[model samples]
Target: MSASAPICLERGDIQGGILRAYGKRGYPRARFLLFHVARAEAGRWFLEQLRPRVTPALDWAEGGESVKPGQMTRPEVTLNLAFTFRGLEALGVPLRTLKGFPEAFADGMAQRDAVLGDDVGPNRIRFWDPVWHGEPGRAGVHVLVMLNALIAAPDVMTARLAKVTAEVVGLAGETAGGVMLLEGHRGADPRWQELAALWGPQPDGRMGPLASEHFGFNDAIGDPVFDGQYPDGAERDKCRGQGAVDGCGNWRPLATGEFILGWPDESQEVAGAPMPLDFSRNGTFFAYRKLHQDLASWDVWIESRALMLKEVWGLASLAEARATLKAKMAGRWEDGVPLVKAPTFADWQAARARMAEMTRAEQTAFLTEFGYASDREGRMCPKTAHIRRANTRDALDPLWDAKDGKGRLGSALNNRRRILRRGLPYGGRDDPDGEHGIVLLAYCADLFRQFEFVQQQWMNHGLDFDAGNDGCPIVGAHREGARFVIASSDPAKPPFVAGGLKPFVTTRGGDYFFQPSMTALRMIGQGLVDPT
Candidate 1:
C-alpha cells in the first residue's frame, strides 16, 4: 500500500514553524532573535526559556490562533527555536544526535555558501555580509528564536510582543544564558538591542492589511499544504484545480516527511533522525536567510526594458509591455496570479475578481492548481520563468521507472527536495537602500539534498533544468551578457531574447540550524539528552 498520510506524526513535539504558514495565518508581526549560550548548561537554560511560550504544532492547532475575517482578533504568538552547530555543543547535545544530523548542517551554512560566476566549478561565497561572515566573537549568534505575532494592526503589536518576548527570559527569575543579536543597536533601547529584536512588516489597511511585501506581490501565495493538514481537515483536494499538484494526474498532498522529521519521505525512507528517535522526531533543519531585493534598479530596468520589449511583443502601450515582462520573469503577476493559468494581463482581471469571490478552498485550488506540462514549448509560460524554475513541478521527470513511468518521477523528485518556506518581508515598499528584503526560513529534513541542491543546481545553474546557462529571471545571479528568452507561440515569429540582465535578489546573510522537537527540548532542559 502507498504511504499513508499523517504517518504517526508527533505533532505535540513538532515546532509550529514546520507546519504553520505564519504569513498565511496573518502573523505579520515577527522578530527573529539570535542568542549565544553563555552558561555551561546552556541547553538546560535554553530549555527553561522554551518552556513558557514555545508553541508546539499540535498545541497551536488546538488553541494557537484567534483569527477573524482576514485579521487576527487578539494578538496570538508562535515560537520555533533552532540551534547553531556551536549552540548544540554548548547545550550538551549527545554525540549520537550530533553525529546523526547531516554534515552540511553540523558544519553550518557559513562553510558552504555557494557562489556562481557563469563558468562555475567551485565558487566562493557571493554574499559577504559582516553579520554572517564575521567570527564568533563578533557575530555571537548561537540560538535562533523565531517569534511570530498574529496581530491585526501595529498599534497593539508592540506591547503584546514585548510581553511574550520577556516571558522567555524572565522565566523563574533566570537568564536565557545568552545575549540576543539585534540587526541594529543605534537609536534603540539597550534591552531591545540585547534581545536582537529585529521586527518585520507591520500590516495596516482598510479591509484588513493587504497580504503583500515590498514588491507589491501577494506574498506567500501558495504555501504547500502537507499531509497532516488539509482543506476541511479530512477531505482530500481534487486534482483538477488546487494548490500544488503532484506529477501524477491526481492532485494529492505532499508526503508528511517532506518537512516533518522521522517520517518516510518521498523516497519511502525514514529520513535522518538523531540517536534518540524522539530527539529528532518532529524536528527539521532550518535555513534562516536574509535576502535583499533591489527595487529602484528593478523599476529602472523594467521601464527601460519594457520599451525594448514593446517591439518584441508588438504591444501598443508600455504598460502592456511592462506587465508582460514582469509576468515572464515572475511566472506570476504581482498579485500572485500565475501566468500559466492566464497567459495575458488582459485575462487576469476577471480571474482575480473570480478568485476574490471564491471560497478559501476554491481560491487555493484555483491559485495553486497549475502545471507546465501543457506549456512544454514555453508558449504560455517561458521555460526560465522564476516560479517554473523554482518549483519545476512536473517540469522535469525523475529517474524513469518501467513501472511508474515519467509523470511520477517529477513529483517524486520534487517531494524529496521540498523545503517549507516560512518567513516574512523585512522592509517597506520604498526602502531605497535600507535594511530591506526577506528573512526566509526554509525547514527541511536534509539540508544538502533539499535546500542547497535547489539553490545551486536549480536557482543558480540551469544545465540540469535544460535551459542551458539560463539563470532564474528574478533572483538568478546571471553573469555578464546574461539573457532571458521568451519563447514565441507563433511558429513564424522567432523567440525574443532579452539580454543584459542583472541579478535582482542578493543574499545578505544566513545560516543553517536544527529545530529540535519539544521532547528533545525537555531532555535538553533536564540535561538528559545523551546520544553518546
Candidate 2:
C-alpha cells in the first residue's frame, strides 16, 4: 500500500469492542459472566441464539442504519462474547484448528505465571478467585459473556443485568448438559461480575463525571489507534498521541494486522497468521485480568515516601512532594497530564485547569502529543515510569543523526506491541482492602508478541528501559526493597530515590480468550469449521 492509500476494515464483521472501548463511550456499567459448556450441542445453540445480539463494529444510528464513526449515538446496551481454549474444545472446535492458535492463548494466563510475575506474592495463582483458580468441584471457565450498558445508576444497572441474566439462563437450560454460570465474584450475584467507571460526586450528591481509579489516577488515557478504528478523516486526529510515529515526526495508525488477524501488519505482510483465513481474519485475542487495588497500602506508601522526597528535592510542601513522586512513577499526573509536557508540580496543576477548558480533541493532543526525545536522560519522565516503559515512543531508537535531522525511530518498533485496552473498574469503595479493582481487557491479534511481551518485559522487568530489574511502581510485582529513582535536570541536585515500595496491585484472577469475528462466530455455532 502506498503512503497516501486509504486503509479499510471489515467493520460489519468485526466485534464492536475491538473498534471502540465501551466504557469510554456511553457504557459506564457492565456485567461479565463466565460459563462452562457441558454439551456441545447446547453450547452451539446458545451461541446461535446470541449471535444476532452481538454488537458489531459498525457505527449504528438510532434508525438502524450504519453511520460514519463518531456520528451515531451508541447502543443502549452492548454485548460481546469470547471463548477460551477449553471453551472452544467444549464447543467441538476442530483439533487442527485449535492447534493453529498461538501458544500463549493455549497456555492461558494461569499457566504463564513466571513470565507474568504472578508466581509469588499476593498475585500468585493460588490467591486467584475460584472462577480462575479452577477449584476442584467447579468446572473450568470456558466462555466469557460481556454486557456493557449506558445506564449509570447502580440499582438500575443491577436490575437490568439481573433480568438479562435470568433471560440467558432460561435460554440455556439450568440442568445437566446445559451451560453453567460460574461463580466467585465479590458481590451478591456470584453468577456475574459487575463493573462501573469510577464517577465523581456532584454538589447535590449525585454522580457528576468520570473519575479516576481507586489509586486516584486518570485511567484509559492512551489506547492504541489502528487502521479503520475510526473513519478515515477522523482517524488522523485520533492517531496524534495514540498511533505509530516515524523518525520524520509523522503520526499514522498502525497496520491493521497488528490488532486484527489477516491484514498487513507493521511488517507489511500478513504471513504466519492462523491457517484458514476465514476463521481468523477479523477475529482477535483478549486478555481478561481482574486487578485488585490495595488502597490502604498505597495511601501509607505515598505518605511515607512523600516525606523522603520532600527532604531530597527540597520541595516547599509535602503535597508537591507527593504529586511529583506520583508523576515520576506514573509518567503522568493524577489528572492525566504528562510529565513530558508539564515537567513540574506547578505545571501539572496549571495544565489540569487548562485542559478543563480545552475541547476534548485539544486536551487529547496536549496530553499525548509530547515525546521523550528532549528528556532522554529521564529528567522530566523517569525511564522506569509506567508510561515510558509501556510505550517507549522514540526512546528506543538509535542515536539521533543530527546531520540527517530525522527523529528517533523507536515508534516503528513500538507499533507492533500495541494492544487495544478495554474494560472498566469493578467492585466498590466501601472497604479499603475490599473487592474493588479494574477488570483490564486488552485485545490484540497475537497475544504472545503484543500482550505477553509487554507484561513480561516492560511492566514486570525494566531491562528494556535500562533500569536494571526495577519494575513498574504502579502495577509491577514489588519484590523486596522495590524502589523508583527520579532524576533532576539540575546538576546540583542529585537523583531522588523513593524506596520501600509494596504491592499496590495484585491479580485476583484472569484468562486468555479469543473473540472471534461475526463470520467466525457463525461458523463455530454452525459446526462448519474444516481445518483442511
Candidate 3:
C-alpha cells in the first residue's frame, strides 16, 4: 500500500464477526447504532483524537496500523457517520442537505445572471445558502452514524453492557453527545418502545418504523438490492459480480408488513430502504429522484421522443428497449465497441469478440478516450451530450500542463473528479403522466471538487473554469432563454439536437459524512473529542 492510503478492514469479515457475536449471546439478530456528525471539521478532529482511545477489544484486527498510504482496503473499523442539520449547527457552518443545496444554488446562479442581464462578468464567484436562506425548517443537517457490536446479553445484561461500554470509553457523562438504545427485536424486549420514544420524533419520521421491523435482517437484505439495482443494469451487473446481490427482492412484500416501517403516514411500508439510512451501507450508492407520480394516470412518459427512440435505438423493432438502451450507452448498436470510432458496423462486432482479451480498466479508458475525441464534430457523440461534457480529456489535452507561473491551470478537469452513479427508477407502471424517473446517487471524495463543481461550473454553467463551454449535456441544469449551450467544433455540422431538462432529479435531502474506522466509533462513544 502507498503511504497516503488508509488501512481498511474487509466489510464481510467485520459483519460476520458481529453477527456471530450477537448470535452467541442468544440474540436473534444484531442491531446497528447510528451517530450523526454536525460539522466536517469537528468530525475530522474527533476522529483524529479518538484514534488511540479505541480499545483492542472493540478492534476487529490485531496490529493493523493506523491508515497508511496507498491502501485501497476498507478501514480497520467498519463505521459510517452521517453529518446532519443539528450537527452542522454544532460545527458553526452552513448546512444544506443535498435536496436543498442544488436547487437553491441553481436559483441563486440564475438570479445573479438575471441581475447581470447580458453583462455577465468573467468567472466571478457567487454564494448561495440553500438551507438557511431558502428553505427554513424543511432543511436541516442530518448524519447517521452506523456501528455493529455484539448484543451479547438479555435486557438487563444489555443495559449493563451499554453502560459499561459507555463508561469504558468515558462517555458515561458527556453532554456533547446523545445515546439512544437500539433493540434487535422488539418482541424480546419491552424497553425497545421506551428507547424509541426517547429519540423523539425522528427528523424525517422514517427511522422509527424502519427500526420496528426486522432491524438487522431488513438492512442485510434491503441495503444491497434497492441501492444496487431496481434501475440501472450496469450497476446491477457490477454488484452481482461482486456477490453483493443478496436475497432482498424476495423481501419487498414483507417490507410493508405490520412490522416494517415507512413514511408519509406509516400506513405504507417504504417501497425501498429509507433515505440516508440506506445510502452506502451495502457498498452501494443512493440515487435521489423527485418523481411526480400521478396515481390517476396509468400512462408514463418514458421517452418523450418515441419516434426518435424507434429511429435511433431501433426499439419497437426486434431489439429489446433495455438492450438497445445499453447499446446506445456504449455508442454501438450491438457487437460492442462504439459506432463513433468504429465507423463501419462490422468493426463493432469484432471489438465485442475481443472483449475477453482486455481488462476492465482498458475498456473504460478506451471508451472514455474515444467518446472524448469523437464528440468534437458532434457527429459520433453530440458535443452537448452528458458523456461528452463529463470526460473532456481531449479538450483539456492542449491545456493540461500550461501554467502562468501560478498554479496548475488550463487543462482537462477529468482527473480532478469522477462519480460512480447509482440510480433507481421509482413509481410503478401504474402511475401515468411520466411518473417514472431516476433517483440519481453519486459517490465522490469531495463534493466541491467532484459533484457540485461539475454541476455548477462545468455541466450546468457550461464553463470548465479551466476548460470552457456549458458543462455536461445530459445532467446539466440551465435557465430558460439563456440556456447554457454547446456547439460542435465543426462549423459545417450542427450540434446534436439537445433538449432542456426539468431538473428531473432534485436534491431532497443529503449531508456530508465520513465513514470512519470501528475504533473511531468507540472514541466517539467515549466522548474523546478534544475541548480545544
Candidate 4:
C-alpha cells in the first residue's frame, strides 16, 4: 500500500488495549487475572458472561461523538480478554486452527529460554513466580483477564474489583467444570494480579501524578502509531515522532498490519493468519512480561561508576557524571530528553527548562522527532544505547542519495519490527527491594517477527548496531565482563567504558496470548468457531 493511502479500521470489533494504552488514557489502576480452563463448556460460559463488558478500540465522548486526546470521559472500569494457545484448546478450538499459530507462541514463553536469554541468572524459569508454573497435570494459563480502571483511592479500586470479580466467580459456579483463577506472586489478592501506576504520595497524603519507575526515568514515551490508530488530523499530529519517517524528515503512520492483524502491512500483503477470516482479522498477539527492577544493585553500580566517570567525562560533580552516564546509556535524559537532541549535561538541563514552557506538541517534537543519520559515529548518542538499539530509527537505512552517497534518515527498516507498548509500572518506588517493576504488554500481529526479534536481536545482542555482543545498557542480561562504551564527540577525547554490569532487569515470568476481536470473542463464547 502507498504511504498516502487512507486506512480505516473496524474500531468496535478491535480490542481497546491494542490501539490505546489505557494507563495514558486515565486508567491508572489495573488488575490482571490468569485462568486455567478445567473444562471447555465452563470456559465458554465464563467467556459468554464477560463478553458484554469487553472494551473496544472505539472512543466516544458524553454524547457518542469521536473523542480527541485527553477529552474523553474515563470509564469506571474497562475490561478486555486474551487467551493462551492452551486456552483456545481448552475452549474446544479445532486442532487445525490451533496448529495455524506461530511455533514460538505454541511452545510458550517458559520453553523459549534460549531465544529470550532467560535461561541464566535470575531470569530462569525455576525462579519464576508459581503462577507461571502450570497447574498440576494441566496446560498452563488458558485465559488472561485484564481490567483497567480510573479509581483514585486504593480502597475504592479494591471494592470495585471485588464486585466485578465476584460476578465472574458467580458465573464460574453457575456451570460445571468451572475455570480456576491463578495465584500471582505479589499483591493481597492471590487469585488475581493487582497492578497500579507508580504514583508517589503527595505532601497532602493523596497520590501524586504519574511518577517514574524504580530506575527514576520517565516511562512510556514514543509508543508506535499505526494507520487508523488516531482520527484524521489527530493522526498526523500524533504521528509526528511516533510513526514512520523518511529521508525528507516527513512522518507518516505505519501500515496497520505491523501492529494489528488482517490489514496490509508495510510489505503490502496481509500475513497468513489463523484459519477463518473472522477469527484472526482485527485480532493481535500479546506478550505479557513481568520485569523486576533491582534498585539496590542499580544504586550501587551508579554510585561507584559515577566516581570514575566523573574524571573520564571531565564533569565537575559526581551527580552530573551520574546523570550524564545514565542519559548516554538510555539515549535519553531522565526527563525523556533524547541524547541526540541534548548531548551534554548542560544541554539536558537547558532542554528540561525549555520543556517546562513549551506546549505538549513542542515538547514531544523536541524529545522524539530525531534521527541517527548525523550521529552514525555514536558521538551524540552511543550506537549501543538502549533507545538506539530498540528503535534504530534511520540508523539502519542505506544511502538514499546514491549520487551524493549520503545516508538517509528513515524508519522504513524499523517499521516492520515495531510493537505497540501497553501496560505500566506495577509496584511502589519507595521500596527498592520490594516487588516493583513494569508489567510490559507488547502487542503485534507477528510475535516472532516483532516482539521476539526485538528482544533477541536488538535488546539481547548488539551485532546489528556494530557494538559486537554488548546488549542494551538498561535492561540487557549483562553476562560476565559486560561493559557499556560511551563515545565522545571530541576527536581528542577517548570513549568512556563502564564495566561490571549485571542484570538490572530480570524477567519474573511471561507468556504469549492471542487477543481476539469482539467478533471472535462471540464465536468462542457460543462455541461456534467453525474452522471450515
Candidate 5:
C-alpha cells in the first residue's frame, strides 16, 4: 500500500534542516564538519549525548508554546547529524544492521562516484584541492554535522557551534577514544572574529559576500514544493513557476516520497530502506560533495564563444550574444528567468526586472510555471540545456526516442529521478585554494536510481538525452568526444556545436550518509537495535 501524501509527517520526528531551504532564511553561514570516531564505547556515548541536539525537519511547523517570563528559546540554529557506513560500525552497530544498508551507501562516496563517473582520478580524494592538503585528506570522515545560522549574528552562532563541538569532543577526553574533528570550513565565516584574526579571511564570492554567484549569475532560482504541506500556499505558486504538475490536470507540490524516505513514491512504492522501518522512515540518504568551479577558464571561453555566435545568428552584438548563450547554456538568464518562458535576450532582461518588481507572492507564480510543451521543436529551449537536462520535468519524451531510445516515458521516467537539493555554494570561484564551489547535499529515498542516475546518465551521458554523446555543457564530465549543441531559432542559421570541453566542476571529497529519524537515532544512542 502506498501513502498518498505527507499527512502523517511529524515535524519533531524528522530532521527539518535536511529538507529546509536555509538559504531563504538568510542563513548565509554554514559549516560541514567531518569527524572520525576512534573508540566504540566513546562513539556510542557521543551518539547518546548528541541525540537531544539533532535538528528535526519540523522547524517550519506553526504555533509554538510561549516562553515564560524567565525562559526564552535561543534564536533557532539549524543542525543535522548523520553518519557514514563506517561510522555505523564504529558505534558498534551489529554487523547485521550495517550489512542491510543500501549498497550505494555501503560503498561510500569515493568508490561509488567512480562508477557514476564523477571525474575521480588517481590521487583519489586529492582531485579536490581543499581535501588534498587539509586534515580531511589525512583522516577518514565517518560523521557529518551540518551547521548553519543566519549571517546577521555570526559570532553568537559560531560560538554556539563551537561549544556544541567542544562538549561532544570533551566526552572522549583524548583522541584514542574520542572523535577527531575534521573542520571543512576552517576560518571560512567572516564573523568568526577570533579565527578570522588568527587565520585571516576567506572571502566567498557568492551572494552576501558579493551580490551574486562567482559566474555573475543569480543562483538557486527556486525548488520543488510538496502538497498539503504548505498551508501558506507559497509552494503552489512556486510549483507553478517550476512547471511542476501531476497528470491529473492538477498543479501541486511534488509527491512526498520523491524526497522523504519511506513515503510512497510517485509510483506508490516504498523505496528501498534499511532494516527496521522506524530507522529509515523519516530518514533519507545524502550525497555530500565538494564541487570546485573553475571561473577563470569559463569566463574566457564564454566571452570567446559569444563573439562567434553573434555573426552566425546575425545577433545585435557580442553582449546580446553572450546573454542568449548564457541563457541557452544554463536554461535560465542570470535573473532566474527560464528560457522556455523568455527565449530572447531582451525578454530575459525584461523578465529579470519584472521579477524584481513582483511582490514576493507574485514571484512565486512567475517560477517553473512554463514547460517545454509549447516549444516541442527545442527552439525556445534546447533539449540539451543544462537545467532541462538536470530536471527534464515534462520534457522526458524528447530524451527517449523510439528509433534508438526508450519510447516516450518522460513523465513516469522523470518522476522517479527527482531529488531535493539541500546544498549551498561555498567559497568564491576566485578563492586562493580553489575551494570555491557548492557543498551539495542531495536528499532522496534511493541513491542509485536518483542521484547516481542523474549524475551518470542525464548529466554525464547523452544517449538517453538524445544529444549524441554530448553531456551537460556546464558541469558534466569533459569526457571523450564530449560536446554541446545550441539549436538556432532561425532554421536558416546553423546550430552551434561546442566541443572539447574541459572538466569544469571537480569533486573534492565526499561521502554517502543515512540521516536517521529522531527515533532511530535514539535507538542508536541506547544501543537498542534488532540488527536481524
Candidate 6:
C-alpha cells in the first residue's frame, strides 16, 4: 500500500528491465501506441491474455498489495497496457490511431519538489516522469477524450467494455507505451451519458459532444457563443464599448469555430522509415467557455453611467463622457483593451493586433508604465487580471520561482503554466438588459499552479507574491459601491476609480488528467505497465 511500492513496480526495476529488453531489439519503431487503464478485474483479464506473450515483472512482496498508500487490500486489479502499431502490424494486428489523453502522467515521480508544505509525501510527489519513455508532444488527450467517448459501448456494458478493451489492448512488448487511466468519472456512468447526449460523440466512439454544455458548478459561467462576432464590426465595437447598440440593424453573433484534430500525418515517410504511431491521432481539443452576459453589457452600463457622469462633470458629448469615464476607471475601455494602443479608435482588428503585440512581459511593462507595477502594486493588473494572475510569467517570488537569484525572470514558468485562451462571446447581442457575456476556455498544464491559483489567489484574493491590493479590477467580484482603483500614468496624479462593476464569469466544473504517448499505449496493451 506504500506509495513507493507502485513506483517501484511501475518505474523502477521492472520498467528498466523491459526498456532494456526493447532496446536490445534495436528500439523498434512503433507505428501506433494504444493506452488503457482499467479496474482490477479488467487488469487481471488483460494480464492473463498477455501472460503467454509477455513476462510479468511482479515481486511477491509488492504484487499482492494495493498501489495506493494506507490500503491493506490489493487493488481489485490494476491494468496498465500499451500497444505498438508497428508491433501490432508485425503480428498481423491491424491498428489505427486511437484516442489519447492530452494531459497524461509522465514516468517521473509526482511534482513533490515543486509543491509547498509538509503535506508533500511519497504519495504526493511523483518520482517518475509520465513521459519517461517518450517526449512531450501536442495531442489533445485530456479534455478531448472526456468531452467525447473514445470507445463505443452500450450503456449497460461500458464498464465491461472498458475492462475487456484494456486487456485486449494490453500485451504489446517493450518499446510500447503504457496506458493511463484518468482518475475521475467513469465512461459508463449515467451522468456521463446525460452529458454525452447533450454534447456529441467522443472522437473514439462514445456518444457526447466534443465539449460539455452544462454549467452550474463552482464559479461556472453559462454557455457562450464559441467564437461569435456581432454584425457590422462597428456595432461590435460599440457593444464592446457601451455594452449596447441602438442604430445597428442586423447585429448578431456567430457560434463555434472550425475543429482541428491533433493527429499526426501518416502519409509522410521519415528518414526512409514509416512514421511513428500517431497516439494523439484523430483527437481534437474543444475549448468551452462560461461567459457572463451582464458583464459584457458594460458598454451600456458605461453609457448610462456616462449620462450621470456628464451631469457631474458637465460634459457635453457622449464621446467626452466616455473619455472621462475611461480616465476615471484608469484604463481606455471595458474589455481591458487600452485606448493608448488603439488611440484612433480603430476596429476590433486593430485592437486584436495591439493585444497580440503585448506579451506578458510587455503587458506588465505597459501596466507598470501607467504607474501600476505587477511586482509591487496589484492595482495595475489588480493582482488578478487573467494575465497577471495566471503564472504571472515569472513574476512570482523566489520560493515559487524556478531559478535562484534571477528573481522571477530566471524560470520557465511559461511552459508549465501557459493557458490557451480560446474565448467566445455568449448571449444575444440584441438583448438590452446586458445579459450577453463571454465564455473563456483556457487550457493549461497545471490547474493548481496555473488556473486555480490565479482564480483563488491572484484574481480572487489579490494575493500575489507581494500580497497587496484587491482582486482583478475587471473580473474581481466585490461588494456594491466598493471603489476599484488603478493608478494613472502620472505617479504624481491621483488614481482613477470605478464603482459597481459586478462579477461576470465564474468557474464551473473541471478536472485534471494526463496525456500519454501512443508508444505508451502499447506498453499498457502488453500488460507491461511496470517499466521498473
Better of 2 and 4 by TM-score: 2
Error of 3 at 267 (Å): 53
Of 1 and 2, the candidate ranking higher by lDDT: 2
What tens-digit string does per-residue lDDT give for candidate 2 at 1-532?
A: 2134667787888888788888766778888998899999889988898898888887767556666554444666777889999899999999999989889899989999898888969999888887787768779999998888765576777677677767777766644556888888766567778888877786489874475888888888888787777866467678888888775567887778888888888888884645578998889899999999988788899999999889987989999988888888899998889999888988888888898789978988887886777787889899999999888887776754444636346455688788888988887678544888899998888888888889989998888788888999999989999888889866778998888888889998999999998999999999988888
Query: How does each model score on lDDT?
Result: 0.66, 0.82, 0.31, 0.83, 0.67, 0.32
User: Over the stretch 1-532, how does candidate 1's per-residue lDDT look in tens digits?
Assistant: 1244434455567766567776666676776665656664644665676765667665232255664332322327777788887778777777767788778887777677543231232122444345455464664557777777775557576566777777765642365434444343211332321111223444353434556656556666655656665333342553233323555555666666777788766667787677888787877888877766777767788888899878876777999888888888878887778888888767787788888788977876677777777777778788888777767777775533325544354455665666778787776544443545667888777888888877777787778657787888777776778788887655656677787876667666678888888887787778887675
After TM-score superposition, what is the CA distance of residue 379 in candidate 3 from its true location, in Å? Answer: 3.0
Q: Model 5 Cα displacement at 476 (Å)?
A: 0.4
Ordered by TM-score, highest first, the candidates read 2, 4, 1, 5, 3, 6
User: What is candidate 3's local distance difference test score?
Assistant: 0.31
Give me the overall lDDT of model 5. 0.67
Better of 4 and 5 by lDDT: 4
Which 10 residues in a row give candidate 6 its minimum summed lDDT? 1-10
Per-residue accuracy of model 3 over 164-272 as CA lDDT, tens digit each: 3453234312324432222221122322111110111343763222221110111111111112121222332322211111112111111111111121111222323
- On TM-score, the stronger of 2 and 3 is 2
Better of 5 and 6 by TM-score: 5
Question: What TM-score would you give candidate 4 relative to the actual structure?
Answer: 0.94
The C-alpha stretches of model 5 lying farther than 4 A from their native spots are 1-6, 60-76, 119-124, 129-138, 153-165, 168-176, 183-212, 227-238, 241-249, 397-410
Collision count of model 2: 0
What CA RMSD would you report for each candidate? 4.9, 2.4, 17.1, 2.8, 5.4, 20.1
| Candidate 5 TM-score versus the reference | 0.85
Question: Which stretches of candidate 2 lie above 4 Å from their native place?
Answer: 1-3, 62-74, 202-206, 209-211, 401-404
Give one digit per residue, the lDDT tens place, for model 4 in 131-237: 88775764478899888876567778767877777777677667654788767556455677778877667548877546467798888788887788876535766
- Which pairs of residues clash in candidate 2, taking residues 3 or more apart in a chain or in different chains? none
